[model samples]
Target: MPPIRTFTAALGLAAMTATLLVSAAEAAPRNRYVQVQGADGRGYVASRNAHRTSSSFTANRSIQTNGGYGLNRNRSAAYGEGSYSGSSQTVFNSGRSINRSASVHDNGDGTASYQRTVTGSEGRSRSVSGSVPYTPPQ
Candidate 1:
């Protein structure tokens, strides 16, 4: 009877210890980020904060290449319930640069209208607006 009681007490203590350790390990959420290998002679890396289902999302990414005379690129984007927006910039080793920004909004009828602005190293900027129908992939 004494041996049986001792075994039961040890088992209960072990279970409680395991539960405490597991809970302590679950800490807070960490921000999300990703890095991808080379694509078309360039590599990309990006990161964003974790968002709940009801919250909007924003992310930033950059791409660059190695060796001499490579190019660098940066971009950021955001998404909300009925709209999305983004911007990007590219810089070349030769001291040339180009920047672009774009936004899109839903039209409530399975289509969206978008506007885009672009500026080049020559300091010229232009904007374009158009609409496109949306069809989900099969």
Candidate 2:
């Protein structure tokens, strides 16, 4: 009877430790910014921010130069309940840009469907979509 009680206590302690470990792994949001300039008045500035969780994440970045050139980009995604969706876009000061998006959903029959699209800087767009068998990671 003593051995049985000891085993049970050890199991309970292990469960609690596992829960705390999982909680500690969740990270907080982060942000960064930087700028540089020279005596010649030529310089650039940049910034980035990001956040993440057990199921979702989002991020963006931007850069600007003193020569009238600039760039911006953004992306985000989330997954849960057998589905996922994400999109991204990038643009430049010269009117050139690219955009993309994708989505996937489980069919509940051991397969999943997906769709994706991409648009280039010249405004020409292309898309490809298909389905495949899905196996969730253990």
Candidate 3:
């Protein structure tokens, strides 16, 4: 081929390749995050796109009261390639110095589970575990 024709063909091929790459990147999933603060509490949320098919979600909250009560919660759902997983935890403290907590997880392939725990200022502790299906809302 003549030098001018060869150069034109190469340029065209390069342009096409660039366009494909840009399209793929645009189709890929991305992560997003948000946070908020209230007069007595704070919260955060996170999510990510997954393989142009599904998405992951996460959130957490913390709060306190002048009477010495406190509450906290954290949760997350993650998707990777062909699999997904989720977890959650919550803790509450009574103004009288007693505390309780619970945690849960979804293994994403048909299995789910949880754990619960309680503690008191007197150094006593209690815990439990179980399983249940977990699904996120649309």
Highest-lDDT candidate: 2
Candidate numbers sorted by lDDT from highest down: 2, 1, 3
lDDT of 1 by residue, 5-96 (tens): 33433333333223223332343333655666675655555554422122222333333344344456666555555566667787877889
Q: Candidate 2 lDDT, tens digit per residue, 65-129?
A: 98889999998876666666777899998989999986666677876666667899888998766
lDDT of 2 at 16: 26
**lDDT, candidate 3, 105-129, per-residue tens:** 4456554444455666676987655
RMSD of each: 22.0, 14.2, 21.1
Pairs that collide, model 1? none
Give the CA lDDT, 0 to 100, for residue 31 in model 1: 68
Q: In what order do the candidates fall by TM-score, top score first?
A: 2, 1, 3
Better of 1 and 3 by TM-score: 1
Which is better, 2 or 3, measured by TM-score?
2
Error of 1 at 63 (Å): 7.2
- Residue 121 in model 3: lDDT: 62
- Candidate 1 overall lDDT versus native: 0.54
